[model samples]
Target: MNNLSKTTLIDQLTVEVYQNRNILGQEAAKAVVLKMKELLSNKNRIRMIFAAAPSQNEFLETLTKAEGIDWSRVTAFHMDEYIGLPASASQRFGRFLKERLFDTVKPGVVHFIDSENSIEEECKRYADLLSEQPIDMVCLGIGENGHIAFNDPPVADFQDPSIIKSVELDLVCRQQQVNDGCFTDLKSVPTQALTLTIPTLVAANYLFCIVPGTNKSEALKHTLSGPITTDCPASILRQHGHCTLYADDDSFELVANG
Candidate 1:
């Protein structure tokens, strides 16, 4: 991990490309864990939000294995979920995070967005839960269409008035779900989802964006090179003083070359 190369995009964001997703996740887990521990030294509790996706598997696995931290004082939250998925469905973002980290480590509190309930009430409920305190950090990834969480370009708002809301998924975002093998086909994917708006995600004191695979090369290009606008939702990360984007070799080749 120490041998991983580092580069700055526009001299505002720090980009580190690891050899592969495995090591990339491991190193990212290390950094986030260290930051969590540092925050805990000054505070009694810390709240964290996680993005559920195959891209986050390595990081979550390594994070659950990290020692010397008290899980009881940490609260967990997930970024988004499909609106129509069955409770027992493995594709549910809540179930995904539970199996990955929540169930393994047993955090003090785990708040999940209940899509089965009223979308309006669910949004208010989750938003209220998040507003109880400032978020310490967010562990997330960039979608193929350059989205953060489910904040796809169609609904991403930099000055969103609400914290969480229901949004229609863009074609590229829906396709990425199938591309990631979360669903059998496009028809099986949910068109609507509950997502934390851009303002909510960026409100965290720190953000760790873990993106891997060559499949993300085009989006990563736009994220690093494009203007800071909702057109490339993840591009807003450039304005955060404490955010870091981690990519693997294949995912960052284009950015590294240019």
Candidate 2:
């Protein structure tokens, strides 16, 4: 349990298991940097969407320290945002990314979901931006309830007609925010959010899903071994040819044991 313990394929998804969260984060960051370097070599710029959570801390920290990626050639976006959180709130997804990633790398362009605006207008605005060009990559995570972004089980749609939409956060999803310490309590978490749809996320050329911690073990197991259904939104990754799910001993245990 001191290094990468396993690498296997499930459907079109690649699953990598490491000894612990630190190793998992380092390995995932290395792979992401390598892919970024390769893509930047061929293209002038790349657009990427990222997830904001305590779970992403190690990976984002390591990624910011990596070399060879031209930050000036990158445009950054976030996968979701609370519909009512003040823009200045530390719990805001955009603010989290700003402090942890964007502020450090300073990507050429950073697009934040304008939660302060009308939900309808904000969704349309973000969707239009996402539609302007193909998303090169997406760095995300799985929720305790098997959600991707804010696409909780209750509302996930693999074939969502819209690029981005407003959604009511399910109980499990909101509790996860408290569990992650992003909020002091479930009631403090916003009940609704704006999220890029499943289709939009899976449309990215490359998907790097970093999920760690024992709290996520059950969800990770369901994602890798359970049926591909909206009930487990993360399970949809199995159908994406270029998606990779990274997990540590704690999170991968249930899947490994099965």
Candidate 3:
């Protein structure tokens, strides 16, 4: 928790503000590592879900470099992946996670969402994989539209029965893909995606939310002060028993000013 300058406990959520994004990621990764160690010491294996995006770059990179943890006892799953995107597409979410962290670690298993397969069967298969074990933790970020994964405002369900479901991408979410340089333009972005539902994500025993960059200021503000509604999907984090939000100055200042 080095250089964590401020903290606010809103409801069940603990929000930590860092001096910068690098520090934010480092501290979040450190906290997650500590939690993982504790879980592994008591449990035979731990399950983890991760979000793939430029916002998670620093946290995932720092986590991959952390030492002394037996990654072989960990099983990895990603939060979402686009439908119909070719495997070769650099923008594919699964490909992004593989290049950034999954390939770097020796997790006992890495379950990827098969978006190319039948959406119904893919959803069932992924849900079965998730239901195999309780998720110990998740490292995620908020989208510019305040989305948690692809559960955009229009599609997010707080009590979704299915663990994994498909959704049509929101305009703001698609625009963010372009802004993050995952695609050259909005037209290149996939309209539909398979996302772990809001209930599935919040079900984790612990949640490490790393949201950075000035582009996230507005979303951060909404999540921090706005009503806890699907209008700001990430706002639901406030109700989690063990969730912490790590944000940098660029994004935190928006809430600070208000």
Q: Write the per-residue lDDT of candidate 1 for residues 1-258, one digit (tens) a residue.
A: 485966565546778889889989999999999999999999999999999999999999999999988889999999999999888998999999999899889999999989999998899899999999999999999999999999999899999998999999999999999999999999999999999999999889999999999999989999998799899999999888889899999899888777
**What is residue 125's positional error in candidate 2, in angstroms?**
0.9
| Residue 129 in model 3: lDDT | 93
Clashing pairs in 3: none
Candidate 2, residues 110-141: lDDT per residue as tens digits?
99999899888888889999999999999999
User: How many pairs collide in each candidate, listed in order?
Assistant: 0, 0, 0
Question: Candidate 3 at 190: error in angstroms?
Answer: 0.7
On lDDT, the stronger of 1 and 2 is: 2
Quality of model 1 by C-alpha lDDT: 0.92
TM-score for predicted model 3 compared with the true structure: 0.98
Candidate 1 minimal-lDDT segment of 10 residues: 3-12
Error of 2 at 73 (Å): 0.6
Off by over 4 Å in 1: 9-11
Model 3 lDDT, residue 146, Cα: 96
lDDT per model vs. reference: 0.92, 0.93, 0.93
RMSD of each candidate relative to the true structure:
1.0, 1.1, 0.8
| TM-score list, all predictions | 0.98, 0.98, 0.98
